[model samples]
Target: MRRIAIIGCGGSGKTTIGRQLADQIGVPITHLDAVYYDDRWNRMDPDKFAALQEELVAADTWVIDGNYASTLPIRLKRADTVVFLDLPAMTCLWGIAQRGWKYRGGQHDSSGVYDRITWGFIKYVWGYRRDMAPRVRSLIAEYAQHADVRIVTSRRAARKMLTELKAAVH
Candidate 1:
């Protein structure tokens, strides 16, 4: 796909899938965490973050990955494809734990934000389905009516979809 938006709750593997898909399709990938947070994990100004996203979406092709709901519509409007990783809460928590351990004392490879796994983050992952899914779904329904939406609910399914996409592209 030319323009892709990979979105989901924290620890839902958005970055993993985005990286793989972008590599397979030969497109640049932008992790919104990197755009919104600095190397020191300080927040960027809201207006600046939105402006940066605007500039990124102006490009011809890209895979933008993150769950910045406020500006989701910007990417959604320009995206030809949107992949939502709707993994279960437990699985998401597990993923977050794995990532925390792997990136302890350092930043994640996918973004400039620090890889600290806090209780708040764990709770967010735990309650994502109940708290965030509905909002995200509504946004997708409203803003991505013309986009091809793929909802994947498990890691295996995500992997299979990525493999299929790679095959199709090649």
Candidate 2:
């Protein structure tokens, strides 16, 4: 795929999966979080965020990781494929629990965001997802009409998403 974007809630493994897929395809990749999050977990200015994303997505072949849809729509529009990790809240919680501890233990994500999935942090993102998810899903649903949007909602179905990526775009 020339341009792929991974969208999902926290702990949904979008970054992890996106990196694997990007590496398999041998293309450049960017984690929007790294570009957006400053040292204290504060966000960069919207204009700056948008500018960086716009510049990055101009590349020929790249996999972008993150669901910051506000700054992400342009890339979404340019994307040839969109991968949505649609696991439910509990599933996301479980994934966060599993990954967060690893992150606390010094694991770094491909998206370059430090893994700091504390219980408090996980709880916060979980709550935040309630507000954020509908928009993301709607975005996925909206984009699916114009482009390829494949969603993986279950653990068992995860690899099917990968296989779709592995298949050459015709």
Candidate 3:
């Protein structure tokens, strides 16, 4: 796939998958967190963020990763493939913990300068399937119906999908 949109709850491996896909497909990767938040974690203005995303998706090829539901339509409309990492909450929670420990005193590759893990953030991750999946699914249905949509439910499934995609591209 040329233009891909990878979406999922925090710590669901979206960045990892996006990077691998982009590298395999020979395209640039955009981590939406990098665009939305500065090194100091200040947020970009909403309108400007949307406009920037519009510009990003207008590219000939890219793999964009994020779950900013508010601006999802911008990428969804342009994506040829949509990868939704629907892994279990416990798996996602463990991911967050591992990432937090790995990047405890430094910046994340995809996220902003610091990897801050708050209680609220944990709660959000724990409840993401219940709270955010429906909206993401509806948006995908509405805007990306023409796209190749893959809902990955487990880490094993994600790996298999990546392997299959790599083989397809080769």
Local accuracy by lDDT, each model = 0.86, 0.76, 0.90
Please, what are the lDDT tens digits per residue for candidate 1 over residues 1-170?
Answer: 88899999888899889988888778878888877877777888988888889999999989999998888989999998899999999888888878778888478764565665678878888888898888889999999999989999999999898887778677
Candidate 2 lDDT over 25-52, as tens digits, reads 7886787777788656787999988888
| 143 Cα displacement, candidate 1 (Å) | 0.9
Count: clashes, candidate 1? 0
Q: How many clashes show up per model?
A: 0, 0, 0
Q: Please write out the lDDT profile of model 3 over residues 20-84, one tens digit for every residue.
A: 99999898788888888887778999999999999999998999999999999999999999999
**Decreasing lDDT order of the candidates:** 3, 1, 2
Clashing pairs in 2: none
Model 1 TM-score (2 dp): 0.93
Full-model lDDT, candidate 2 = 0.76
Which 10 consecutive positions of candidate 1 have the poorest summed lDDT? 109-118
Candidate 3 off by > 4 Å: 109-113
Quote the RMSD, in angstroms, for model 2.
2.5
Deviation (Å) of 111 in candidate 3: 7.2
Pairs clashing within candidate 1: none
2 versus 3: better lDDT goes to: 3
Candidate 1: Cα lDDT at 68: 83
